[model samples]
Target: MNIHVSYPSRLYSDKLSLDCGSTRICHDISVAIPDRGFTVIIGPNGCGKSTLLRGLSRLVRPSAGKVHLDGKVISDYSTREVAQRLGLLPQSAQAPEGIRVGELVSRGRFPYRRAFSTWSDEDERAVLAALQATSTLELIDREVDTLSGGQRQRVWIALALAQETPVLLLDEPTTFLDIAHQIELLNLLRNLKETGNRTLVAVLHDLNHACRYADHLIAMRDGRILFEGSPAEIITPSNIEALFGLRCVVISDPVSGTPLVVPR
Candidate 1:
């Protein structure tokens, strides 16, 4: 069966700037996120990738400019309304001690519930589906602290999935995972993008993985976007060098025919 999904119009920033106290992190940044694609943001550490992600999610109010969601100012929407349309997974998410996996994931449904309404069948279905999709259904009753790093990461992702939003933003989702787990998580994200008409945005450190899995790439440097395009168009050695100030060898992945970067 074919399912038709309606996504909010692409989100974009106009002359966006971010400041924390007296420090300026991002400046005059403007870019449009595609309506339905996996877009990876890559850059050197402390280059404002995370800041930009926060701005996009409305977690950080921009110092200047505005973020538009579906042609409407994002700050104008009610918090619950925005939550129902967008979900953000930060790099470091801590579950309360002794929290059960199911209970942790169920929090994502909060936006769908009225203040005094009890959990309904639809909420239960969404929670179960998210757990199953992330392959964490079997761990539903387990304490989050007992899971491996990879498993815990999946649980967090499941929580975001349970939100059932059209726009999903992840900040450094593979931060603490080993190589195998990193690949696993990336593959899971790829599967999620393919299975639904959703837009996935992630801050990725591994350029090769970003190129391989992302349909679009946004390269940033020193708080500014250096380039934004398809992996094939933006993953050249010159671009990589400009973005990360590193010399690298760029080659094609044998399986996916995407660019692979070998740092020099």
Candidate 2:
């Protein structure tokens, strides 16, 4: 399915609602992910942030309303069609047993290949670039099971990057990473947005990191968005308290000048 991907990819929801089993987590909510920017969703656990991402990426179908991609209904497209336009790095993804890093990463090219097609030069370049982008080129031949926790996370991210989709959704992408690697991954995400103009969305727990790197911030609570705006506009003591029930003082981060939340 050859889908024309326009620049600054458009991905948004309209009156979107979802049900996980019998309970309704996400209500009638409408959110527009910023085109070609780093948008971060911050909330406490079980706040439906992951559900929202799943719905947006079409992993979980919305029980009502719609999720639109490039101005068309997301469900209207085939799975491969959607995979070619959007990619997702889900939380706690497990690689197949004995799968090598290169083999795992190369699987991302499935959306672009024909049935029984041989690997092309384009596939090799994409896999190399993905490994390079995640700084895992040296581990390309290593078995995924042999890698450390952080290394496995990076390899998973490489798999997502190798998909080469215009819009990418990540759920807790910094999990299992050290502070240094977390910062590195965040920087890489921002760089991906700026350099490729890719629309990047991530669900993060660190409010300070979200404020530091996100062009747009969404505060979710009880499966609903309480606030959405630029970090400076949306991240305040009042919003923090409302979102997490934790009273905190907001200060400026000296390094990035973004909002810094300090608990009182």
Best by lDDT: 1
Q: What is the C-alpha lDDT of each candidate?
A: 0.91, 0.89
lDDT of 2 by residue, 1-264 (tens): 111223333888877888899899887768888888899988999999999999999988898989889879999999999999999999857789999999999998989999989999999999999999889999999999999877888888889989999999999989768998899888888888888768999999898999999998878888888888899998888889899999999999999999999999
Model 2 regions lying over 4 Å from their true place? 1-9
Q: Write down the TM-score for model 1.
A: 0.95
Q: lDDT tens digits, residues 1-264, model 1?
A: 111123345687878898877899988887888888899999999999999999999999999988888778999999998999999999768999999999999999999999899999999999999999999999999999999999999999999999999999999999999999999999999999999789999999988889889998888888888888899997888888888788999988989899989888
Candidate 2 deviation (Cα RMSD): 4.6
Candidate 2 at 246: error in angstroms?
Answer: 0.7
RMSD of each: 4.9, 4.6
Error of 1 at 236 (Å): 1.2
Query: What clash pairs does model 2 have?
Result: none
**Residue 242 lDDT in candidate 2:** 90
